[model samples]
Target: MKAAIFKGPGAVEVGERPEPVIQEPTDAVVRVVLGCVCGSDLWYFRGESPHAAGSIGHEFIGIVEQAGANVRSVRLGDLVVAPFIYSDMTCPHCRNGSTISCPAGGSFGNGTIDGGQGQAVRVPQAGGTLVRVPGSGHSDEVLRSLLALSDVMSTGQHAAVMAGVKEGDTVAVVGDGAVGLCAVLAARRLGAERVIALSRNPARQKVASEFGATDIIEARGDEAVQAVLELTGGTGADAALECVGTGQSIATAAAIARPGSVIGIVGVPHGEVPFTGTFFRNIGWRGGPAPARVYIPGLLDDVLDGTINPGLVFDYETDLDHIADAYRAMDERRAIKSLVRVGGI
Candidate 1:
C-alpha cells in the first residue's frame, strides 16, 4: 500500500506501507476512497508539534473491503466514514458525549496505527467507529463532503455545541482554516442569526460568506476583537467559537464573547486560554477534539441531503502517490484544505 510518511519536520513523502487487514474481531479494513490533510497535520509538518515517523493522516471515507466476524454495523462493500479517532461507543466517556476521552479509544495514523492516508485502514471497534453511508453512487462533490464529516465538519459542530449556540444568537468564529469556516456553517445550521467570521484571506472570506457568515472581520488581535464587538453593538457575540489555539486567537475569543456566553474551543491548544479574563466577565469555555463518531451520523444526513457542502473547503486535490504535494499545498496556505483521492468507490 502507498501512504504518506512523516520524515520529520518539513518532510512528508509518499511511500509504501504494509496493507492493513482485520486485526480484531470487531475490526474492519476499509479501502480508502478519500482522505485529506488536516490543519493540525501541519503542526508536525512544521515541527511545531511531534508526530511519529510512519503512517499519518486521520480524515478519510472509504468502502469496507473486509470485516471481522464481530463487525456487524458495517459489512464488506459498504461505504463508510471513519471518525478521526476509534472508540468503543459503550465506554462511559463516549456515552457521556466525550468519545475523545474514551478509555479504550485512540487516534489513527499515529505511527503504529494504519492511517487513513493509506490504501486501507484497520478500524478497531468498527461497529461504533465507522458510520456507513446510506446511499451509493455518490458524486465526487458529495464524497468530498462526506469526508468532511470524518473530522472538520464534526469538529466545527462540536465548537457550536460547546458554545451553546442557539436560535437567534449572534456568533463569532476565531479562525479561517477549514474548521473555522465549517464553524461558520455549523453556527448557521444551529440557527445563529448572525455569524461574524474573522479572516483576512479573500478566498476564505468568500467561503465563509457562502457558508453563511453574516459578517467578515479582516482584523487581528484587539482590532479583530473590537470589530466583532462593534458588529454586535458593543454587547459582544452571544457565543464565540475558537477554532485556532494561539494566544491571540484565544484572547480574541475571550474579548469578543458576551459576558454570559461560552466559547467553544476545538483547536489543538498551542497556547493557554485567558482564564482570569474570561472568569471576570462571567464567560465560560468548553470543547476539545470533537467526538466525531457521535456527530457523524447527523452530519452525514445533511451532507447526503445537500443541506451543507462543507467539501467546498477542499480547494486542492491529489492522489495517494502525490500525498506530499497535498501536504505542501496546505502548509504553504496555497490551498484552504487539500483533498487526497485514495481509491475508487
Candidate 2:
C-alpha cells in the first residue's frame, strides 16, 4: 500500500505503508477512489498546528473492499463516503447531534490510524461511520461532489444551521475558502434570500456567486465589516458566518452580525473570540466541528441529483504518487481545493 506521509511541517511525501485490514468485527477496509486536501490540513503543513508524522488526510470516498462480520450497514463492493472522523452513531453524543463528541469516536489520519490519503483505510465502526452511496457507475463529477460531503459541505451546512438561517434572511460569510463558499451554498439551500461573501479573490468570488452569493466584498477587517453593515441597511447581517478561525475573521463576523443575532462559527479556532463585546451586544455564537455523519445523509440526495455541485471547489487534481503536489497546491494558494484520485471504482 502507498499513502501520504506527514514528515513534519512543510514536508509531505508519498511512501509505502502497510496495507490496511479488518482490525475488529465492526471494521471495514475501503479501497479509496478519491481523496482531497482539506484547508485544515494546511494548519499542520504550515506548522501552525501539530500533526503526527504518518498517514495524514481525512476526506475520501471509496469502495468497500472487505467488511467485518459485524459491519452490516455496508457490504463489500459498496461505494461509501467516510466522514473525516469516525463515530459510533449509537452513542449519546451522536444521538444528540454532536457526532464529533461521540464517546467511541476518533479522528482519522491522526498518525496512528490509516488515513484516507492511502490506497486503503481500515475503517473502525464502519456501520456508523461510512455512508454508502445508493447507486453504481457514478460519473466523475458526481463522485467529486460526493467526496465533498465527507467534510466541507457538511461543515458549511452546520454553520448555516447553527446560525438559524431562515427564509429571506440576509447572511454574511466571512471567508472565501472552500468551506466558506460551501457556506454560501448552504445558506441559500436553507432559503436565505441574500448571501454576502467576503472574498478578494476573483476565482473564489465567481464560485461564491455560482453558489448563490448575492454580494462579494473585496475588503477585510473594518472595511469588510462596514461593507456587510451597509449592505444590510446599517442593521448588519441577520446572520454572520465565520468560516475562518483567525482573530480578525472572528472579529469581523461579530461586528457584521446584527444585535441579538447568533453567529455560526465552524472554522478551527486559532484565536480568541470577543466574548465581552458579543455579550454586550446581545450577540450569541454557536458552532463547532460539524457532525458530518448526521448531515451526509441529508445532503447526499442533493449531490446525487445535481441540485448542488460542491465539487467545483476542487480546482487542482492529482494522483496518490504526487501526493506532495496536492498539499503544495493548496498550501501555496494555487488551488482552492486539491482532489487526489486514488483508485478506480
The alpha-carbon lDDT assigned to residue 175 of candidate 1 equals 97
Model 2 lDDT per residue over 1-345, tens place: 999999999999998899998989999999999999999999899998889999989999999999999999998999999999899899888889899998888998998898888899999999999999998888999999999999999999999999999999999999999999999999999999999999999999999999999999999999998888889989999899999999999999999999999999998777889999999999999999999999998889999988999998999999999989999999989999999999999
Lowest-lDDT window of 10 residues in candidate 2? Answer: 88-97
Q: What is candidate 2's local distance difference test score?
A: 0.94
Q: Which stretches of candidate 2 lie over 4 Å from their true place?
A: none
Candidate 1 residue lDDT tens string, 75-174: 8899999999999899889999899998888999998897888898888899889999998889988999999999999999999999999999999999
TM-score against truth, every candidate? 0.99, 0.99
Point out where model 1 deviates above 4 Å. none
Clashing pairs in 1: none
lDDT of each: 0.93, 0.94
TM-score (C-alpha, index-matched) for candidate 1: 0.99
